[model samples]
Target: MELKELLDIERQGWDALCASTGASFYGELMTDDAVMILANGMVLDRAGVVESLRDAPPWRAYEIDDPRLVDVGSDSKVLVYTGIAYRDGAEPAFRGIMSSTYVLTKAGWRLACYQQTQISQ
Candidate 1:
């Protein structure tokens, strides 16, 4: 797939995380062996990540900023970006850089790995 298409999938996943909508769609966007590194440095597998998102607490908004393709191979790509998380009646709760890898599989582009590093104010 083209870079724009892959980035669109990435955006969809983030949007679902922020809106708490389309849980199944989010789950389907991930690979079976996907991995995620949280801002706290804890690592999680596909199921863990999906479950966490499904049960995430309400947030007012989320934004993926400055997303760019960092690397790309024949069937995979790495995206680097920063994200801001907003909560109701509060200042932005989290600002972090995120790196995610996506692989083109038979079903389409699926996230294979992700890492988030929190930026302290």
Candidate 2:
């Protein structure tokens, strides 16, 4: 996919998180074997992601910066970016380098993996 398309998809994900629809959005967007390596040191498979997001609070605001796209092969791509998200009543925003990998599938490009590396102030 092109950079714009990839970034749009990423933005959609962030929007979903802000709207408290992440569990459903991610469930549909993720591949069966998808995994998310969270900033909290949890390595979650697709099922785990669905469960966790069910109770996760929505983010109030978010931004993605310095995004770069990498081709893994002919049918796969990865997005790397600096992301910052804030929630109400939180001391600090969630600042991190986020990575998302997508693989082309018959249904469409599906998320194969996602990871968050927390950035320290």
In order of appearance, the predictions have TM-scores of: 0.87, 0.95
For candidate 1, lDDT tens digit of each residue in 17-116? Answer: 6678636765787788888899887898877877777877666788878878866788888988888888777688889998989898888788899899
Candidate 1 stretches with Cα past 4 Å from truth are none
Error of 1 at 22 (Å): 6.1
- Consecutive 10-residue window with the lowest summed lDDT within model 2: 85-94
| Root mean square deviation (Cα) for candidate 1 | 1.8
Model 2 Cα shift for residue 34 (angstroms):
0.5
Tens digit of per-residue lDDT, candidate 2, span 1-121:
3778889999999999999999999999999999999999999999999999998999999989999999899889999999999999875578999999999889878999999999984
Instruction: For candidate 2, list the clashing residue pairs, or say none.
Output: none
* Residue 75 lDDT (model 2): 86
